[model samples]
Target chain A: MYTKLALLIFIFMSKLSASVVTTLPEFAWIVHNLNPDTKVINLLQGNEDPHFVDASPSFVFKVAKAKLLIKNGMQLEMGWLPVVTQQSGNEAVQLGGKGHCDASQNVNKVGVIANYDRSMGDVHPVGNPHYTLSLVEMKSVIKTIAKCMERVGLEYSKDKYTELLAKFDAQIANVKKLLKPIKMKKFMVYHTEFNYFLRDFDLISVGSLEEVPGVLPSAVYLAKTAKKAMDEKVSLVLASNVSPERYLNKFKDISSINYVKAQMHPLSSDDYLKHYENFINELVDNVSL
Target chain B: MRLILLMFLLVTSAFAQNNNLQLINWFAGADIVASGDNLDQGADKENHLNDGMLVREFEFSAVSQIDQTWQGILTLAYHNELQAEEEHLEVHEAMLFSSKLLPMANVKIGKFFLGFGRLNRFHRHDWIFTEAPLVQKSFFGNEGVKDTGFEYTRLLGGALNWKLTVGLTSGGEFKHGEAHEEEGEEEHDHGGNPAPYEPTRYLRASNFIEFSTIEGIESGVSYVERRDGEGTRSSYAGLDLIYKKRVNQYIDRLVQFEVWQRTTKEMGEESFQDLGAYLYFEKGLNRHHGLGLRFDFYLPADLEEEEDHDEHGHSSIDGITPMSNYHAISLSYNYYNSEFMRTRFTLEHHNGVDVEEEEESFQRAHLQFVFNIGAHPAHVY
Candidate 1:
């Protein structure tokens, strides 16, 4: 009976030791990709906006058990993530520590609307925080995630992380090369979320339909927009899958413009590679001279 | 019903083609508020929608980017004052934007919300509260918050980032209301006389005023001085210093300070500019629940009052009049069921002190539940 109890204790300790924690969905993707053997508990999901996530009790419990905690810095999760970390009483994943990695660092963010204030309808006051979508940006984020994991003394499958990261880099480079040939590098987007992606790909984003982030446009405004799109001879009207469709139909018949949807946030199981491949393929398919 | 059917047809037609233009993102929400005045100044208590108290708003917005440099957004909204029995339905915002002009700068020349103060430029759907702050609402008025304008924004410097923005607006129209008169006039009064013989006091123009009446230019510069540290543990410190000045020839000089910070758990300091500065703090108790506290003190500039005669040879005081200094403290808790749905409860206290009268204190409690029906871009910053 003593031997059995000792074995049970060992097993429980081992299980507890095996747990790894990650902040932000991008880091979760990297951890899952790098070490399939380790169970990764993701603090945030892609479907929900990470900027204003509500910190719940379960989230604190998860943080307490985490050996590794990764976060997107640059004030992206300022609203809730800090509170969760503080309440968890886990000093391992504290800010400026090895546990936190802001993915926005070192990425060339283009078309970042400057002087952004609260009035601009929930725009990022800092540089673009959605750097995870760009392959070049993703590489930087992966490197930081790997470094954070290493700090926690967790053995990451370096071979797998590097392999996946290299493949993703090549895939992104190929897409960039493919897009280079297209003379019309200018496009329109529904919102300001795609600044980093557009900058990485050397694409120009001209305008947005809504006057502000969440406010709807009027018919008079739509008519004026249609006229502008026609006059500018805009090549593509870029939108996201999450945005609405009613207002975009006015430009469908216009030969000068083609509507394309760019996925700002990946909500599916597809990693960065699959998502970008699908995005680029859709872009090439829809956007043509 | 016909409009809804038309919208449905338009959406269906696009969806059938597997086109990007045919997406429909819709969201609807209502606010339930209860407030009482200590003075009991005859303010109505019944829930009425048109008075801008209890509101129900439905918004539908669509975005289709034509290409890299051009994009368009079309948004329509229906707002109703549930208690006031007034409804407003219109296509609120539709603009096509482009950034192909320069590498570091983007020029937006369309009918868009002119970037003004922090609150004026943001969308109501994304705000923590239904109404804007008192300062913004009282000063800018409703339409003054947005106008037909041209904006130029550009980023400069690498290591030390600096942003500059300049915009010109055609100014916004003021809400019209009839001037008060003595209670004795039966049929109509012209120039304070209860007789039709009084000549029309200098034939006034129609109710609709021209835009040139309030045309103005607003410009501002912001510097984000950030020092990158070892990681989040050391407390990523950054200073967002902004100076904005607007002049319209009518009245001038409005400035605001909006500074805050986020620190990691190890930093130990959660206070945001607590040392004689505007600040607020929000912390999550758990993944599903969070609490936020905000204390705001509005110190308006001193007023310069002058007594002047009106065009009709009537004597009246005309000039900058002192507005009440308002202090507000708000406590809010949020319950997030999912990304698209959430319930929030806010208790707010307002201490409004007029220059002459004693300070008045009021307490307001608001409960709101929002369920996003369609897809929208997540808040980035």
Candidate 2:
């Protein structure tokens, strides 16, 4: 009887070890893609702005049973994630716990503005928090996610995580190959969010609709930017950018420029590869438009 | 102090090297304001909360890791206009919060704001209007209640998934209530004591509920009770609701409502009740521009004293009663110069009806600006 009880306990612990939890939908995708058997509870939908996610009560319940929790740190989800996790009261999932992981910490953060001032418009002093959008940064972040899972004893299978990483690395390499035509090309974006993506792809942005991040473009500034763009043949526009899109519509002349757009994160995990593929295809389709 | 802070940072960073404790962010900010020359002091002449917005509020707040299981937050503040003196420094909040202390519960202790109604517990920098709501100022002192206490937040995970908080305070002193009195100024009795007193004990409890994130609906109810060694006591209960929706990428629509009731018991006086409520709406036009409007109404426990006494002790005016009430409406526009700097413009109209002086109404306009120095913590969603 004692032997049977010990075996039952061992089975229970192993099953518990396989379960994991993540905060954002992107982190959940990383986990699900790594181990299909692991249950992934994504707190936010892909289309929702992660910056202003709500700490809905449902998260508290979901996180309470989670064995591990992964998050996008660097104040990216500053508005809500920490607060909700604290309310979760799950020791392993709380910050600094064994099951806790801050995915951004391992990657080299870009767009660092030293001695930054808030007057710069909601600036992230450490750096831009959207490095997750960069393929190269994601490559580095992927390894960290795997290592964190291993440390927390949540790695479902060794080869499963490795296979997913290898496949993704190949896909990213192909994406880079497909973007050779847009390499060293110049364009204009709606927000500074695309800075890391452009840098990763060897592309450049000549100007932005709002040069001051987060601030709406003034009429005088817009006219000057348009004149400079027309003069320099910088008529390529990266629309559907993360920030406000209505600003472009206000200036009909500027909106007339060739527009490029992409959506890398979709709501459904099954759509992840498709969106990722479309993202690269869209860039290649309109890079020189 | 600088040396101490630097040493602390170095030690913490070194101590928590591998996934260790480190200072994530620290924010410093200053708030300054200037009022228009043409202003209305309102019917209650005693409410002179603003003179001129100067470099008034200087705040420094830091969040640090104490260890693997503990996180510490320290906030120090300095103001030029808090008292009769030219400059005053104070410790705004110092607390340790941990989620591992209890099973499925978050615990916090040390000096922190009470878990009061929505706006009352907000840091000074987080107020939506240029000035504190008249109800809050009259209910408590200029600064809301802060005390040494312990509190816990836990989810009653079930079908409803209700979040609950319970807290208790061993002792704390209420600010001198007479701060509102002035020689020639009219006084409205909002029913708080005019003298400072130490509370023998205090208790607070609250419950919060949030619906789907897509709809962005959150509601909470809070209750608080305090007692002095004497027979005096006060009990407050309030409900708050917030609705937010992303109308577009740049614009977010926010509507909030709060209603509260306060009851007091004195040694020899009959119990008194005061009621107040506020409705607020803000329309975000873009990432950096927003327009807001707020409406306030309250019925006070004590009547306002409008001096119309004849040579005799009796008053000359008629229809005077012991009950008083007030209503105010303010329209505001905010321009965020940057995430670090914010400028606000407010036009407020206030009126009070007491025993029987003509329901006096007046208007005032204000312009205020706040500039952040370092990393600021994110506000509650």
Candidate 3:
């Protein structure tokens, strides 16, 4: 009976461990691309907003036992991760520590809006925090993840990270070359989050439909924006699929302006190249006018 | 007053006459609250009975753009305080705000609430609870809602997400109750001086002299001096900074710091300084929950010299004793029910400093329900 109870406990622990790693997108990506035997227990899905997440009570339990912790640095997770680390007493994930990684470190930032001001709307003041959209930057982030994987003494395919990086580079370069011939550089967007991607492809952001972050434009504000779009002869009204449609409806009269939805968040799938290819193709199709 | 109302009606009617002006949207909402307090034994503790009261608040706001470069907002509020059988009504906030005065800057002017502290800038109706933090309530007061002032905000740099703001303000504090001669009667009767008491008879409504001495009334008062008119000479200046960043795609962090100073020339004495500073950090673990930590410090210039007691033996200084230094740590669980409602449970620890030796540390648990009646996307800069 004693031996049977011990075996049951061992099985429970392994199952729990597998669930924890699979919950996070980055870890899931790592597991998908590098190790089939490794189990991810509980990683966050990409559909959720990361800024205001609830660190589940079980997270402390997981982090307390975790051998490796991966995160996006640059003060992004400062709100809840620190508390989790502290509660779990995990020094590995502490700031500036070995288990920590900032995917942005070596990533190539693109389409950074020049002279972007906070007063313009809810715009990213920094060059662009959304560097994940660029295949080149995504490759850098993957390399950083691979380094973390190595630190944990996990046996990962030696060339997997490198192979992924090369593939993304070639694919992104081709897209960049293809987009180079487009003459329409100026576009309007509902939000300013796309600055990095647009700048990389030489797109010019003329204005946005929303007056500020999280706020819809008042009628008067919308009218002025519509007038400005007409005045500037902008060709595209870029937006997000998740955003409200009322604000973009005003641009319908402008035949040249086409509404395009762009994804700004990361995805859970490990197929980064497939996602980028589809995204870029959609963007090109929308602006083909 | 009737004519003013008539003129307002005419202007609104004319505005409505233009179908184009009718395109603007408007929203309104309110909350009801009940509160009770227990005061420790003290010389003035007798008046601090366990009190219960109800308050109803109403607000209306509109946003519109003037041409492509300018955006405007107009908001007005009304509040009614009811205690037992009595009810009182007052204007809460009335103001106009404009953005894009320049390509990268926004300006807010008129009688509007100033964003001196994080809590001060948040609309009361949107608060998690009916009451504000005790420190904020005691220092700023009810109807500390708005000041007649102008503020300018600018966003600088995109990669760094740095933001800055500067403001100039006309300071006139508002208090609940009708301003009248009867309000001064307590001071005049206690002094038994008819000459000083005489001013009460002719005092205009809401224009009672503030310095009148009543034997034991502990009134929270702030003085604003204006060079050109009553309450006009007092001036205030402020600065604010905000920094935010996303860590990977799952975590977000924000840091906000602010400092403000106000100066007023006393009727017959020296000018005094009212200084305040605040720092706060918020982290978003994911989209629905966050944790916040905050520190605040305030210093009032005219501390009564315990030795300088008047013949009548009353404290002359009108402000609450400075908090000197205060800090709060909060763990918040936010449930985004929808675009219009959010519920948050915050466990907060408050530490107070530099008060009477007998005062103890202040702490409490706050569960807040935030009702976002409307949202204009947050200006991210």
All candidates' lDDT scores?
0.49, 0.65, 0.49
Residue-wise C-alpha lDDT for candidate 1, range A99-206, written one tens digit per residue = 545556665664366566444554555666767667787787777777767777767786898798789878977887778756465677665666667767778666
Second chain only: TM-score per model? 0.58, 0.77, 0.56
Off by over 4 Å in 1: A1-18, A110-116, A180-185, A213-220, A246-258, B1-381
lDDT of candidate 2 at residue B27, scale 0 to 100: 71
Winner by lDDT: 2
Candidate 1: what lDDT?
Answer: 0.49
For model 2, state the Cα shift of residue A170 in Å: 4.6
Instruction: State the number of backbone clashes in model 3.
Output: 63
Across A1-289, the per-residue lDDT of candidate 2 in tens digits comes to 9999888877644433335656566677778777777766677666666665666656666777787778877777776677777777888877668878888887788877777654576567778887756767776777888888789766556687677667777877887898777676668877666777778767768878776766678988877777776766663666543545556765436645666544535664644555667777876786554
**Model 1 lDDT tens row, B106-214:** 4655455544334444456555453334433333222223334466654432212233556653332111001222234232211222222211110001011111111
C-alpha TM-scores of all predictions: 0.42, 0.80, 0.43
> Per-candidate DockQ versus the true complex?
0.02, 0.32, 0.02
Tens digits of per-residue lDDT for model 3, B290-360: 66666655554454433221221111111124324544455555554444555555554545442342332
* lDDT winner, 1 or 2: 2
Docking class of 2: acceptable
